[model samples]
Target: MQRNTLGNTGLEVGPLCIGTSTLAGFTETYGYDVDDERAVETVLAVFDSEVNYLDTGNNYGKDGLAERRVGEAIRRRGGLPEGFVLQTKVDADPVTGDYSGARVRRSLEESLERLGVDHLPVLALHDPEFMSADQDGFGPGGALEALVAIRDEGIADHLAVASGSVEVTQRYLDTGAFDVVLNHNRFTLLNREAQDLFEGARDKGLGVLNAAPYGGGMLVKGPAQQPKYCYGERDEAFAASALAMAEACEAAGVPLAAAALQFSTRSPLVDSTVVGISRPERIRETLALLAVEIPPALWVELESLRPDARI
Candidate 1:
């Protein structure tokens, strides 16, 4: 329920942002169900809970259906909160794996029409690796140019890049264009790359939004249930580490989800963490977890269980 400023953009976001990727079936790209109604309900509940930040993307569905659904939900609710912040990603080409300047412009225009918003609170480049691989295709002359133009024209309030790698984040930081960065699974018990990112973001005055705080459900469900879109496979050592952390949480009377959400926020560099909610009950569960603080001794134990190296 705490709020933090998003870098220098003058935007205050909740500690837990609502992630809409699952709502659009991105999780199902491997094997998950598409729950449009439940997704809308979740968003509504998030707003009701005073969590005003929503993160989505244009390529979430066949033709920006996810953005449309979010837009409709806000409209049906009469409108979003007075100072609510809506953030969405731009993918160059949904059908083909192509990212270019022209595609970026087209995507933003279409997203605006679908969302029924004149300007986006925050716009992020979907994937860091893809953008780095084709810098020209996504660089200033390309998508970045379009994004800056939009900001200048008052079509977007700020620009951001959502990535999964430290290297990719550093590249964007070097450009000095992004106002914030969205990172995934970097600061988890299994990885500590976030430490470096935190330092970098602080030095550059960029706000950090930590995604996949639960390691894409692995931390919540445990290793017995493998994550659908995980970057690596689960092994015995990884399973052991996860179990140790889970047991520590149990012993300390703290839910793993609570630890996950609070861990990132404890870092001064991290502004917020995004948690996906499929059901209203899930929101209550997460909120309850958020209310409990992880003890210092418990944090030390949790850190001891971290993997020595990345997978």
Candidate 2:
């Protein structure tokens, strides 16, 4: 994998980044539990791999367990790789749902302690669009304001906006406080809702991260097996489109996972594609998927088979 400059952060990152949401054991979301040993081993695998970027969140588990597992791996290795980039997002208090400036600061501090790091390369205000105006984030004494202060304090190298809503993300980018933008499940094979958001971020010299190329599992697991897009039950038509795409890939002698992954990796708008891994084998599988020889005709057919409406 070739390394590329991540916007103006002066950091070099590969086209793939390891996401730790599932590694934290979100059984309800992924329908599986990742034991502590398994999660730590997975991070160790990533450290030995070619990819140098990692993404985690403050509330990825019951108590930021994902970051703790990552920190454990780092401890065994003595430290982070020489040029590794570790990014984590801030979340509202799980108990009180407070996203105030003070809460943002506390969330980051907790993340640092969990990851066993004093500073971060990038820190994102995660999922702020879910809150209303003048509260949680983007208002007076909100999380967004604290993010800027944190960056200014040299606690974090750069700031990022990682949200699902395209319009909400564009609004954050417009503030010009963010150096990177990350959107998941909205730019995958079955969805193009983030197209304009990516375009705008690219034009502004901000890093673009396209996460969840698998549409939360359907594209790779096969519609018959997964039957969901982004872990949410979609309309029958959406499931039908996924089924057709899986069949198309089969006819073309390609793995549906490869097409789904490369759909984000091969795009010009994306600097990195975030993939979740809970097991050690996934490290090698993801790399193999990246190397698969996808025929050009398969891309054409997949594009044509895109849902008439975005999921």
Candidate 3:
């Protein structure tokens, strides 16, 4: 896997980043449970693979279980692999809903403790939209200030904005505090909502990561299997288009998963694509998907069905 410059952060990472949300056993969301053994093995496999990036979040599981699982793998391996880039996020308090400056600093401390590491390559502010306007996440003595202080203190080398909403993320970006910007379920084959946001970030020299290329599984599993788009109510027109693309992929002797995964990996504006994996075999499958060749005609057909315009 070839590594590239991640904006101006000065860290090199492969195009594919392993996501640990599923590894945390978020069965309610991903519809499956991943035991600790499985989760640690998967992370170990990732460390030995060509890919050099991994992403996690503070609230990914019950009491930050995901970070602990990844940390277990690191402990077994003695330390992180050379040149590997690991990033995690800060979330509002699960019980108190506190997203204050104090909470922000504590979140990084907690994540570091869970991951069994002293430092992080990147620390992101996750789901700022969930924090109330006056929740102390932006002004002085707020989350943003805390994150900047963490970076300045050399606890986290870089800061990032990670959110599901473009508006909320842009609000943080406008503060000019982040070196990377990550968004999920927005720039996939069915949705181009983050296209403009990512393009602008690249222009500003910020690393951009596009996550959930399968639109939360509908594109890869077929609308019949995954029924929803972006893990929510199905968009009727988008579902119909997904069906058409699935059929076209069948005719082209290609798996829809390949097109979906490559869609983000092939984009020029994206520095990395984050993919959730629970099993080690999934990594092998991902490599095979990356190797699958898509015909030009197939791209033409898929593009015809893509969100006619960025919605």
Candidate 4:
């Protein structure tokens, strides 16, 4: 429940951030639907709990439905709790798929409208890899330009770079333009692709947010329930590697989910770990997992697996 300052952003947030993609009912993508009542309950539960930060995106639903759902919860509460921070993202146009400077501000405006807030303490560029830097996102009249302008205009307190690829994330971080950097499905136990990126961001004093510690739900559900990696179908090797880790966890008397959630938090370079939650009970479960202590021997055996090196 203790809060950590998210790098130079001057905002103190809980180590666990509530991710809202599941609340948007992106069933096709997230594998489940959370109705509005359930979404509001989950948001309020996390906010009322020790967790104090919530993350959503502009394109998280059919038409920014995720932001709207979070906004509804905020409105119902009359405002966010003291010290609570709300974060969202901007990127290519949902309709036109154009990643332009105009789209950047327009997206923020749309997100603000959906979230029912005037300003955001945190806003990130959703995915720069999808936007050719030279042509759209990092150029003169691109998304970054507009994001900086908005930050200077006091519309957003801080800007962040959120991407799935290390190369793309580093490309944005190299510019020294973001206050925070978020890499998803890369720094998990099964993948160390973002290890260097996390180090680089910490060196530059930028906040680092590691998301999807479960590796697209593999560490949480195993290959039997979900045989996917980074949202795509995984091969036999990937499944076998996950099975090995699960067996080791079982032997060590630790839950795979507990190890997965703590893996990111244990890193001194990681400022926050964002986790997606659907039901209110899931929030309680995650908090309990965060409290569970994994034995050193378990870590030793899990390290021997080296799924990142193999798969």
Say which candidate scores most in lDDT: 3
lDDT digits (tens) for residues 1-311 of candidate 4: 78888989889988898888777767766676878898888888876788889999998887898898898889888888888889999968876788889888888989999888999999999988877544657779988899999999999999999889899888888887789999998888777889999998998889989999987688898888778877886656667787899999988888999998999988898989999888888888998999998998887777777665564
- Please give, for residues 49-68, the per-residue lDDT of candidate 2 as tens digits: 89899999998998999989
Ordered by lDDT, highest first, the candidates read 3, 2, 4, 1
User: All candidates' lDDT scores?
Assistant: 0.76, 0.88, 0.89, 0.86
Structure candidate 2, residue pairs in collision: none
**Between 1 and 3, whose TM-score is larger?**
3
TM-score of 1: 0.91
TM-score of 3: 0.96
Poorest stretch of ten by lDDT in candidate 1: 226-235
TM-score of each: 0.91, 0.96, 0.96, 0.96
- Measured by TM-score, how close is model 4 to the native structure? 0.96
Question: Which model, 3 or 4, shows the larger lDDT?
Answer: 3
Please write out the lDDT profile of model 3 over residues 122-212, one tens digit for every residue.
8999989899766867788899999999999999999999889999899899889999999999998778899999989998999998888
Model 2 TM = 0.96
Report clashes for each candidate as comma-separated counts. Answer: 0, 0, 0, 0
